[model samples]
Target: MTETGESGGRKYDPAATHNFPDERLNAILPDLLSDPEITTYLEAQNVNAVTRKGYNDHGTKHVEIVRNRALNLYDLLKGGDVGFNGAIDQDLDEADEPVIIALAATLHDIGHVVHRDEHVYYSIPLAADLLDRLLPEFGFYDASEAVRMKAEVLHAILCHHTEEDPLTTEAGVIRVADALDMERGRSRIPYEKGGRGINTLSSQAIESVSLRPGDGSPVLVEIEMVNAAGVYQVDNLLKAKLDGSGLENHIRIVAVNTKAEDRLVERIEL
Candidate 1:
């Protein structure tokens, strides 16, 4: 999918709703995926995290999931007729919204390349440098507009973790999307190698997470779990990210445990 998007404009994979529906995203996707610098940082982050620290997946896979969900959340909000324009304050066009989201989500954790302890801080400078190089490829915006977009994207990356209050709707979207990557396959590499840590346990409990338009809100996040333990991923982790995400009023979250328990955790005691 990334290969196709990189090669032929932004031809997204024909998965459920995975395509870049926004025209702005369609323009930016090809440049983003094809950037060797961006790809290097994405891969390097995982080396420090998954290899050295034994953390869950934090490379291309994790970023891809976050980028997809962030844009999907953006779509849901826009589809619900919410008029809050993330680009308005900066005097940019609304078409700039998805560009901010896609860049922020893709590079938010690249700071992990420096160290996982404060990867968010590390990501800002790295992302800024890459943005300076890549923004020219978008073409629709002027140099001044590109500068403002860079600031917005950096803000979203800065606020994606640690419960920082996100000032823009785009930043909030990135925060929530980061937390949404807590499903099973995300931690599979670590768990399969005999990791029984809490991160692995919680992710393993989550059978699936589906996001869609909500009945009452703009977005609905439905989490299906095989064991009650998955609640920790939501209650402690997702809740923390969502607390200051600025999407509190726009999104709904629901988690349910299936009656069918997988043998991985059929019987357990804390």
Candidate 2:
């Protein structure tokens, strides 16, 4: 974590990914994050998401948060005895699941480097290009395996947005994990810049979110809210992503206000 890589009051932390149990993921992450090509893409994306649109982070900080949450969610589901495999694609070895998740989460928003409008569609070609250059560098995947991995990663990126449906559990996990970066820190850019849109206001209301094993479900998403207004984030955005994420039945979402609800701005924008 460096002071320069932070934005919107959020600091990028690669520590959790280092703790991931997957040897392939652990080996690949340090190289992938430091790759000049990938770093360039993340910077360009912020130009669009932050400088262009005043949106929450979609750069290194955002990706790191999603990567951590995606892996943690995968771990909770696996530990809770869920039947779904992270590598839901039949051709992929079960061992490659975390690699798929980390890769997809890392590259998913690079398409934002192209444009924020339908960035999901733009991400496909860029990710495919990077996969070509990086997968071979790992010296692990043969040509055939590398091609299959490309399809899997592209699928996850496309499906992270609601426009596409996720066919694999891995894609679904990426979709849901993308939305989990909704704490107040993510709203600092918009809020500090004098933006009071609903997106920023609701996100600012979120204090923290945690994932753990659940008694009734494979995973529990417990959200701590500073005010009731944050419910809009859970019910409107998160619930939509979760509904089609295939892990819907396996995960439970609950939000609670830790204090008396404060008055949120009434002037709202979506």
The per-candidate count of clashes, in order, stands at 0, 0
Model 2: ten consecutive residues of lowest lDDT:
1-10
What pairs collide in candidate 1? none
Per-residue alpha-carbon lDDT of candidate 2 for residues 1-270, written as tens digits (9 for 90 to 100): 222323222233445433334667768878987999898888889998898899988897888788878878777776776655545555767658878888999999988877899999999999998999999898779998998888888899999999888988889999999998898879898789998998899998888777777878878887877886787888899988988888888988888777654545322211
Model 2, CA-based lDDT: 0.80
Judged by whole-model lDDT over C-alpha atoms, candidate 1 comes out at 0.80
The per-residue C-alpha lDDT of model 2 at residue 110 equals: 86
- Model 2 TM-score, 2 decimals: 0.88
TM-score of every candidate relative to the true structure: 0.88, 0.88
lDDT of 1 by residue, 10-127 (tens): 1233343532246777867888887888898888899999998889989988888888778777777877776645678899887788889889999999989889888889999999
